[model samples]
Structure formats: structure tokens, C-alpha cells
Target: MPTRDPDGIRRVTDAKALSAMANPFRSRMMDALKVDGPSTASGLAQRTGQAVGSASHHLKVLAEAGLVEEAPDLAKDRRERWWRLVDPGTRWSRAEFADDTAALTAAYAAEALTLQRQFERTQEWNANAASVPEWDAAAFNSQNWMRLTPEELGELSGEIVATLLRWSQRTVPDDGQEREPVFVFARGFPAQP
Candidate 1:
């Protein structure tokens, strides 16, 4: 239900939506929709281990915010409703902040913590799967020092993001075969003087 802009990108312009997703449960719900595909509220509760009522409430909130769409499920019981993510990569406009530095900071902190937790979980999974020889494992840890204008740095960031997208496109899931989840995290910023 989220509105698509001229570029075909769904724009999450609602401040409430941003704050709603700041919650861990809602964030997990979004991730579930993106990774596991469309599912009913009951299905999401089962996957996330959340109470059915809680999942249903969060789904309603997401739907109101245009983050998700309810699809009629013909395969399931006639009464059951299926929910799907409107846009897996939806983003907010800076104008939404409108000089509210405190709100913006809080939102950024919450997002950072969520991403950190995800990375930690993935690392734990990788560590536990070390005995599995069939699992593909690779880790790259390195830093670079370079001098560049702001424009150059922005370009570099775009190139890195594009490369990662390409990698994701090349990855194909094995049907009915168990495989390790691959997690990639990169943090880059100017060094302190």
C-alpha cells in the first residue's frame, strides 16, 4: 500500500512508520517478510515466536504505514489474509526529519543497534557451522587509508553498494537443501583526528 514515487521506489514518508519500525519486533517482521516471502499473521507469529495478537497488531500498523499489503489468499482457507512487504528496500526522505536532530539521532541509533544485533547473530551461526565442511565460509576484514573529496567518497560508497547487490543477485538458494545464511556488514567513516 506504500506509494511509489516517480522513480518506482516506495517512499516511507510517515514519521509514525519510521518510529514503528524502530521497535525490534516490527523490524524482525519486516525481515521475515523480505527473507521468507509473504505469510499470514499466524505464520509470522510462528516464525518470530511472537504472540499471535502481537503479530497481528504489528501487521496492522505496517499496513497502515504502507509498508505491507494484504493479498487475498486463494490457496489457503477463504478467510485467511496474506501479507507481503510492499518494498524490501524502502527508505525515508531527509525532509521527514525536518531539523529534528534528536528524533533523527534516536532513529539512527536504533537502526545501528538492530544492524549490530543482526551481525552478531550471523557470526554466532557461522561459528557453530564451522564443523560443516560443505558450508562455504569467507571473511574479509581490512581497512584502507585514502584522501578524497566528498564526491569521490560518495561515488566509492555507490560502487561498493552496487557490487554487493551484484553478489546478492548471483546467490541462488538451494531448494530443499539446508544452507548457511550469509551476512555482510561494512562500516566506513572518517577517522578521528
Candidate 2:
């Protein structure tokens, strides 16, 4: 069995888990929960535009698959149950989806939608970046072409994930401090056209 990684990510080689995550809305809910931390179904519905019942149902599926869990610490009352990601992130190889066509197709579609969401958010930030001087100065948008073997590519990917996880784990004290959530999404793929 593989051990825990520094990036707080659990690589999913199981086709069952992959199929469970195939739904676009489920993926979005997971992303929102990751960003907002522990959140109730109503909160997710407001952020994700899903009905409260629908959010609850999808969260149940994710929870059964060990993707998300209840965070009672953040709940306001007995009736409310907050959800959070079981891990900081999820990753899977192409091989994991190779045997199941439905799972593979769903996985790709979910990834495409995720990238679209990221692009939209980036545009939104770039438009208002000037108003927030700190973020504006620290924000980045860069791309470079690299020629490397598969081993080298994997090594580089691991390094980036570790660094990002370290930064992501840094929390802010809620003592009247100005704070905002930062989304750090990264992708490394072939440069082929």
C-alpha cells in the first residue's frame, strides 16, 4: 500500500471512486467545499446553485465513497452537518480509467469543466486585480514549454504539489484580520497539438 504524501492528496486508482466523482455537480461541490472548508448542504447549494436536497444527496454519495466527510466542529446546530474533503486533493492516472469507458469519458468531461471554471475565475480576478494591491502584486500567470522524460515530469509534478499543499495548509486566525481564499489549481500535460 502507498503511504501518505506530503501534498495531502490521495491518488485514486479505483474505478469505483472515479465513477462516483464523474458527475459534474459533484465535482463542483467538492471543489467548493475544499475552498470554503466545512460547509452545510444549504451553503453548498447557494455556492453551487443546486437544490438543498440535491446537494445533500450528492454529498451522501461522496461520503460513502470516502471523498468527503462530516465536520461537526463547524456545524451551528444539531440538524446541520458540514462537509469537507477527505483529503486536500485527488489525482488519478489515465490507466485507472482505461478499463471503464463510462468512467473514462466522465473523468475527461469533469476535467474539462474544471479547467473552464478555473479560466473563468482567473478572468474575474484579472479584471479586479488592480483594486486589491496585495493580490495583484502577488498573482501570477505564466506558461513554459518543457521537454522531459516521463520520470522527470512526474518528479516535477510532485514538487509543485508539495509546495502548493504547504502554502494551502497555512491558516489565518479569525481575529479581525483581512483574509481571503486563494485557489491554486495546476495542470501539467503534454504540449502536443
> How high a TM-score does candidate 2 get?
0.81
In the order shown, what is each candidate's alpha-carbon RMSD?
3.6, 2.9
lDDT (Cα, 0-100) at 5 in candidate 1: 50
lDDT of 1 by residue, 9-50 (tens): 466655666776777777888878877889999999998899
Clashes of each: 0, 0
For residues 15-53, could you state the per-residue lDDT of candidate 2 as single tens digits? 556666777778889879877778889999889998999
- Candidate 1 yields a Cα-based lDDT of 0.72
Error of 2 at 22 (Å): 3.6
